[model samples]
Target: MDGFPEKILLATDGPVSMGTATRAAVDLAERGGAELHVVHVWHTVPSPHARGFIRSGLKEIGQDKLEQQVREIVETGGTVAGAHLREGQAVEAIVDQGERIGADLVIAGSRGMGRLGRLALGSVSTGLAHRSHCPVLIVPEGEKAWPPDRVLVGHGSFEDTEQAGFLGARLARTLGVEVELVGVTSESGDAQEKLHDLDRELESRADEIGKVVGTRPRVRALVGNVPETILGLYAGDEKRALLSFGSKVLGGAGRMMVGEPLDEVLNSSRGPILISPELHPASKSRVPEREQDEGPQRPAVLLATDGSEVSLRAAGYAARLADGLDAKLFALYVVDEYLTFRSGVHYGDFIKSLSENGREATGKVRALAEEAGVECEELIVLGRPDRAILTVAEEIEADPIVLGSEGTSRIEHVLIGSVSEEVLRNANRTVLVVGGHPEYARPKGESSGVG
Candidate 1:
């Protein structure tokens, strides 16, 4: 299906961090043995009175910037196949050049802004993601290097998912890293059941991808706020992971913005992102079509920890269980608001202490999951530990909730009113409580008894 990029287009603006885009383009070109083309599109004068002189000056500046970038690429041990300087609107010029050259991928740089309203993507990058016929790789200003350790493919609609998965899997293979396909569904209906169905569908899709890509991809389906959930999984260790997703074509007859979830991800992600526009035609003939009612969900195992010794033990078990079951792992550490408020210590100091402890607790689980080669999403939130655990489990449609039998006074509160006894009474799902005798404890969710 021509998954591997054979021709790459690097679109640069004079002022933005062109070096970042140049380096990424070179690295990708070297890895895939692709031809790298550098292009700089200069804005033309609007008024006809000063058009000839101003336009000539702009052309000279564009040529110099384009040559400078080519030199930087050569200095960085990359060969540029072609250098293009065009006069027009930046987005239109870049897209036209990409299409004319039949480029497989387009690489560009963004400012990487900090706020939601002011997303990092400038008009050009956003426009490329929306209008380009090929996949666009937007390298943020602050990103370290290219050829990430892993590629995460975010599922959208059926066609988008198929195209994104194919491209992401190819990139992962070229980089010699693992690829994971993740789908996020809204928090409605039977989340667990939806997760189960999603998991099955992803498995099926993964099998098909394996047949083509020569390696089966790991799959995950989560139930929660769509953008937030996807961003959470994509968070932490941003430089090491590359997120690739299909940017669904939105808006009607007029020009459209980048749109919801992609917009949020662009604002929040501090890493390199690959956006495959819906108009990308490469996967239409390659990936087989599938009909489904709605996007499916996947299975996840939730581990609630308090940073106690027993909780660490439970974390290990949770990681192993997720690995064994081929499921995603959700590590949650909730700061106990009620307990912190009731403590005689100062409120701010006590809350800070809990937040630090929560980070440590979730960090341990992340490490354990990494060791086991399990995909783990770490979350540290503020609330009553038991209530937080249940809420997260329900939100993520976690099949089993893991906890420790014995803990500190903080967990002692959970044991008394929330965790073991109360959770067992209320939770409709599985509750695995790791106690002193780990071998003798039977998981509460399943009917199978373990002696």
Candidate 2:
């Protein structure tokens, strides 16, 4: 099984202010046994006659910058998968390359573009966080380290906090780091009562997070400025701790709703923060009454099952999730072609047996979804499990593909258990692997598994 970061992309703004991002990328790649790739985008001012000359000069400069970053990595015993130099807008080019490479993570400096120039081309880090499909890690100007010793999840409202806490816990587990849920209260008259209430709230959140991630995190409640209190927790040991929250805290309209405290968090010069797009703030504008009442629709959740105990567990979890989010559920079972072909003499009989098993597996998922009161559709296909899951997910516009970490205990289908890992490595969207083991995974070409 492959690790969380099978591939890492570092989006550099040039030779200046890239040291922190480069270091963080190299550290993560080495720790996760991932391939490291770098890209730099350069463009000239509007010019018709001297365009060729300007383009040539910019390309040369971009190549030099990429080489420098690569050299630093190689010198530190890190391997470089590739280096890309493109001519276009920084955010678009970097986002395009990130998608093309199927990057598991994109790391960049927070202030890659100058402060004044940010108005023209939005901050690379912010733009990537808003645009990229993969997770974006923004390393502050002087911040260092990849996976800090401690991970702090800043709690806002219950909904956003839960979303951020889930993602933060997953990342903390993958990096093997200690995690804590933090909340801040600013009441003067009843300060003690507010603090107590806040502490209880954090503990309650921690319990719910433990139910999902299997590890109950520590909780901390403070009294001070929201951004200052959160950021100050690791001021001296910035390299040893990480701050994470939902992207809604950074949105224009969301900042006002969240309070002025969040504005400081975004403007604060200290960070090596992680932001999840779980809560996207809708732009404020006049809309029809009908559309307003309906609100925005969320995508369906895809559940891949193989009739195993763990698969059943995943089905229950996925069903509950779909119910909570008011999203549809898709239950899929893939008949491994490799197993049928390997049956040789009994190919026909084996194919029949597999088809029957597929129906049973998807049927179980449907039953679970029905119990949860979630709308569901059953799909059975013959192909590689990982490939079929991804293809179906794309076709249905599934946001998260859920499956068991491993599969049934059949010798011929042993490799199929690792299909979850393969899907995670290739899928452009989020993947939830229920009941996973310590080791990550990726399947070989010859795939056959009932998972």
Candidate 3:
């Protein structure tokens, strides 16, 4: 079960902005018995008709970068299979060479703590990530990869995540490190009860990961926004190290996409990130072996609503999707706590009306789903709408979080009602934002049971 990458491609430009990539790559290669290819891509090669005057300078720059890598490899005692100096686009050269070398993974840099304000992927890394032939692990800062005592898996229910979880667990097992399944939750009432509930729910999935990696994983859930919540786990302790997850990437074979959540994680955290390819080429199937007999299982779909026609329409779309996958439909009605955040004589009335309206809206959605022959589960939680939706999705481990593209029309609500938009941006899995606008949705009178 030694599935470590035999050919590892480490892409770099110079020493300045590689963040944690170079150090992580060296240690990973040395430990996993992977042969490393340190590639420094340069666009200095002259065109067929261009002058040769600048050729020497470009070559010098490329060689200098390669020298730095050599020094790094020597220091880390890592084996270098090759030192590549390629021409043309940095991303293109890295990807092409990676494919030619039959690379199992590409290690690249992210713009951590850079001008992007700790929230942007470097342009070259972004290009390589979206266009690569294999999975790309982006480390945020320059830190040695050895002494990684813990491996964290961003757990979710997406089919793609199966590969991520199992692969990460297997790697941790091989490295003899601890594995943790971290999720973000937004449950109310009791904090201890919420954590227990999430942990209990994750037990089944943790067992699956344990079977793969040969040890059970510890499951944990924390309250907060999705990206921030997960990134917060890093905490720079340096002992609990290496974060791994599965993300869909663009291009062929994988047919999966790495969405905004991953981008945010790479930008905000300075840790080694291991991303599993969507297709799971090693296993050659999205689901595990035992489940293959059960056939292709669709991801559970979550549809958020505010009881508007627009939201109902989105629920309809979600139902159709659930029917297609033969999966359960989760109809979530979020009573936006923002409505009650302000105190006044009208506050209690607003809270009661909003909660009742939320339940009513979810009831309608259940009817819609049942009529379409899709089994539906209804849940109502009170919190900031976006964070609540994300937390509930994590609680249920919904795969694709579906919602209306817009929200209620109240000026305050609209300003605050960007819940769906925010969910679409930050959700870890596939987000189906149906329709173009919220204009045709139910009007505000519906909140007071007027409609």
Each model's backbone clash number:
6, 6, 9
| Candidate 1 segments exceeding 4 Å error | 15-18, 47-50, 112-121, 143-145, 156-159, 236-239, 248-259, 279-451
Model 2, stretches more than 4 Å misplaced?
Answer: 1-3, 16-18, 111-122, 130-133, 143-147, 157-163, 170-176, 188-193, 211-214, 235-239, 249-262, 279-451
Using all chains and alpha carbons, the TM-scores for the candidates as numbered come to 0.57, 0.53, 0.56
Q: How far is candidate 3 from the true structure (C-alpha RMSD, Å)?
A: 12.5
Clash pairs detected, candidate 2: 1-440, 1-441, 1-442, 2-441, 407-417, 416-449
lDDT of 2 by residue, 1-451 (tens): 1235688899886654347778888877876678999998888777878888987887888888888878877887888999998888677688789889988778887654554443222245645654555567777655445447877887853225455677677667877888899888876768899899999988998999889887788998888667667667867553577777664421221111222333345445355677554323222231233246876645589998888877898999999999988998988787675564356433324544666677788888999899989988776555567887887677566778998876666542456557877898999999998874323334557456656
Q: Clashing pairs in model 1?
A: 113-120, 195-297, 198-296, 198-297, 199-297, 430-445
lDDT of 3 by residue, 1-451 (tens): 2366787898876664333677777767877788888888776654775457678778788889788877777765667789888887666678899988889889887653445423223655655644564767776554454447888888643223676777677668767889888766654568678777767767878997777667888987676666777766677464757788676532232222213355466545666677775533222233465256666544678888888777888899999989998888988776554444353423324444555676688889999998999998766554557877776676555778888765556563464347767887888888877764555457765775655
Q: State how far residue 163 of model 3 sits from its true place (Å).
A: 2.7
The lDDT ranking, best first, is 1, 2, 3
The CA lDDT of each predicted structure is 0.71, 0.70, 0.68
Please give the lDDT score at residue 263 for candidate 3: 47
State the lDDT of candidate 1 residue by residue for 1-451, as single tens digits.
Answer: 3568899999876543345666788888999999999998887768758888988988899998898888878877889999998888677789899988889999987653344212323546755765576789987665464657888888742225466788888889988999988877766888788888888888988898899888788998888876678667756444477888775432111112223466566656667788875632111222233113223344689998877777888899999999988888988777664574366654334545666676677888899999999998766555556666776676566889998876766536456335666667778899998865343346778677557
Better of 1 and 3 by TM-score: 1
Q: Which residue pairs collide, candidate 3?
A: 19-141, 19-142, 20-141, 248-256, 248-257, 248-258, 249-256, 249-257, 309-442
Instruction: Identify the candidate with maximal TM-score.
Output: 1
Per-residue lDDT value at 144 in model 1: 62
